[model samples]
Target: MQQQMIDLEGPYRLLYCSSKGDKDGVIQEIEKGVSPNLADYDKRTALHLASCEGCTEVVDLLLEQGADVNSIDRWGRTPLSDARIFGHEEICKILEGRGGTDPVGLDSQSPCYEIDHTEVEMDGATLIGEGAYGEVYLVKWRGTEVAAKTIRSSIASNFRVKATFMKELALWQRLRHPNIVQFLGVLKHSERLIFLTEYLRNGSLYDILKKKGRFDPPTTVAYALDIARGMNYLHEHKPHAIIHRDLTPRNVLQDEAGHLKVTDFGLSKIAQEKGAYGYKMTGGTGSFRYMAPEVYRREAYGKSVDVFSFALIVHEMFQGGPSNKAEPPEEVADRRAYEDSRPSLSSFIYPEDFKT
Candidate 1:
């Protein structure tokens, strides 16, 4: 009996080779009579995968071999759209030159508040804030000042981080409450991920506390109500509850009207279930200082974690600042967990109702 030949000719092999940036493999497949425009189940062609992965040579080869430049995928995305979304500038230019069009448009049926990147003027923009993941800049859009949050290139390079950023943007766009910061739009770019939001002139709650030590009882009560309303809105979100894993003062901004608005949904989680235990969530997701005991222990927690953090914020309002400021944040969290240490509330500083 003759040995049977192992069959390997299929769209999957071609797609895999294209996705892995295997130029020689792609050439071999094309030579073996595989259509250059052959698409996978999702209608994603070799050109689409190559463009997404920034495989410049493979993209050129596919185009030269007669790959369709304007093929649309299952999600109404073209090869050019993937290139633009993934920040493959060269691939985008190449596709555009080949008459590729993003006719479906990034704004069409997308979660983001989309705007042309060129519309936002960054000339003479001021650096307003920064965190581990990105920087915030004070920029102008359509003659109005706005806060532009840009993810650092180093961090944005991670595919998972980009996905999370998009997911958070989707959640952010759906939120429309006075006590919550307004999301303006996302600046479409070929190389950067930039989000635009309303620029608050009064800065954050942390800055206020640092400048004035603490608010009076009446003011604190008002601010607390504002925060509570915002958090309540988040928890009561339709379809799913959004838990703000990080609810520190720094993430709360004060408006020119003296009203407080909850901002920064970077670490928020959408609870898939609204049961007694809520959704099983990841621990250590937020700032250690405001981290709930359950979260610090890497246990499954729920929306109550936000409540715990809210209580701490209330405590900070009465106490002027975080307790045990000299101690490291992790140590403070440890003390709170093991020793049940809490910031002392001053009888003179807070009203009777507040104390309760």
Candidate 2:
């Protein structure tokens, strides 16, 4: 029975070793008569894992052992597609040489060009916004204006950064909602990875709150409803719930039509259904001022974390901005989590219904 079990598990062992870049273990599995093309539950073959990981040696070994280079995973991604998405240039060259093709089709237009034949100067000139690992540029694509989100070239060569970008890109591409910012397509650049989206001229909710201080009750209600609808769509996603871990005004944008749309999903978490509280999540995610108490405490949390953040945003809508501006944002978050600190709702400022 033990021998039977080992034989049954040989394919998984091959996949594991391949993902870990364990060339020798892969060789052992092959010698034990396991096919190099053995796939996982996701239909991801050894070649697919090796390519995505940038494990060139393991990739080569698998190829030599007759692995199918064009094998498509459950997501319709081939080994070459994973390699390209992760910025593994050398591995990409090897895979392309082996006739590997991108089964997962991405928009092929280059959206980083400028009008009037002038070179795009990325030196803070065309820069519109900045994120933790990327910069957003206002660029021209086929005579239309779009926001190009680019990973900084300095770190674009790093595999981990590319992997994270790809993960976010994959998730964003599938989302369809009026309250969510539309993902236009991807642009392949030699220096960095670029993805495009519809550029919102009105800017973010943060900009609006900064300028107006606070909104009237009717306006606040409209804005809050927009955010709630978007959050509802995300949390109700099929297969898994997506928590916008960073649900703050800064990450929400206002469209030309004056409706709010959710953007910047960099810190979002796709919650896998487990128990009541959802999956174990990474702590310290998102801006401190809007972070949920459970997240600040690093405890297991669920979709309600976004609800907590939504409440803070609604508070800001009524109060003009984040409270306790005198102290650092981190201190404020710490107090909220540990001391149960909350912003005061003045009786004069809020309507009796709102106060209740």
Candidate 3:
């Protein structure tokens, strides 16, 4: 009876072997009467582990031995889900071709869960940037380069954070503009929420400006025009007007061809009423350096807020510093000042004025 129970442990051992990519160990374990359907602590079966590891051989062997492909883990994640989340294109294709089940439909429950860190594989991907809420990686998808934004599991669990993520996805799906970063798709895993979009190799305009001191006249004008065009499209072309509450150089990415793309819509809002730009009282929505005077004051404003930020960016492009430069006290005071009494757009004095 003890031997019988040991033989029954075949499936669990097979799962371990498959996860480790040890084909010989898997065969040996199976010969000892181990079941191939045994699950781990997370209820993930051997097939799930195999798919996640991108071990095509292990997956094929298990499938040939009559392993159920439709089985889901505790979180209702099938092997197909693992393949997609790990970006295992070939394995995913094979599973799909073999009539694998759709993991997305297993549970109508919110697709938020904890993932084992060891299972995630970041292949052909490079981490390029990070922020308070998440990190951004560059990946190649189907021969095209893309930017994959991943929010950590802990952050995704917060209601506000999750809402912000969903809202960004909604905005991206409906937005159609050349100057905006093209929305590719989203990947939800037990460990992270990943967003894939066009990858801009040149990084943000802020980095370039900070490194190079300032942009030339034509370059500055061109960048400004691209931002304006993207904002105009977002505010006017959508079913509901969209307002990009956070517009900063860091959110503006540049491609190899020098085309600018607006990105990071996490703080964006949809405008419902005519002439209403959907300004929120939330104080921490935007970056300090690029934030408009009205944004800091928590006053009701409209699309003009964006225009104000744009003007500041133009100043930064030419002045080699942020709008608040050379006036620390005034900058602090301006934060509490009313929106109507804030300094005019001319506050961004051009650098050429003192070039003599």
Best by lDDT: 1
Q: Give RMSD to native, each candidate.
A: 19.6, 15.9, 19.2
**TM-scores for the candidates:** 0.67, 0.64, 0.58
Residue 131 CA displacement from its true place in model 3, Å: 3.5
lDDT of 3 by residue, 291-338 (tens): 667777777877777776777677777766575556663454356354
Q: Which ten residues in a row have the lowest lDDT in candidate 1?
A: 1-10
lDDT of each: 0.79, 0.76, 0.68
User: In model 1, what lDDT does residue 297 have?
Assistant: 74
Candidate 2 per-residue lDDT, tens place, 74-101, comes to 4466888767765689999999999988
Clash pairs of candidate 3? 10-34, 10-35, 11-34, 11-35, 11-36, 115-190
On lDDT, the stronger of 1 and 3 is: 1
Per-residue lDDT of 132 in model 2? 52
**Which lDDT tens digits does candidate 1 get at residues 241-309?**
888889999999988767789998887888886733544545455799998888887777788889999
TM-score of 3: 0.58
Alpha-carbon lDDT of model 2:
0.76
**In model 1, which regions exceed 4 Å deviation?**
1-109, 276-284
Off by over 4 Å in 3: 1-124, 159-164, 277-279, 325-356
How big is the RMSD of model 2?
Answer: 15.9
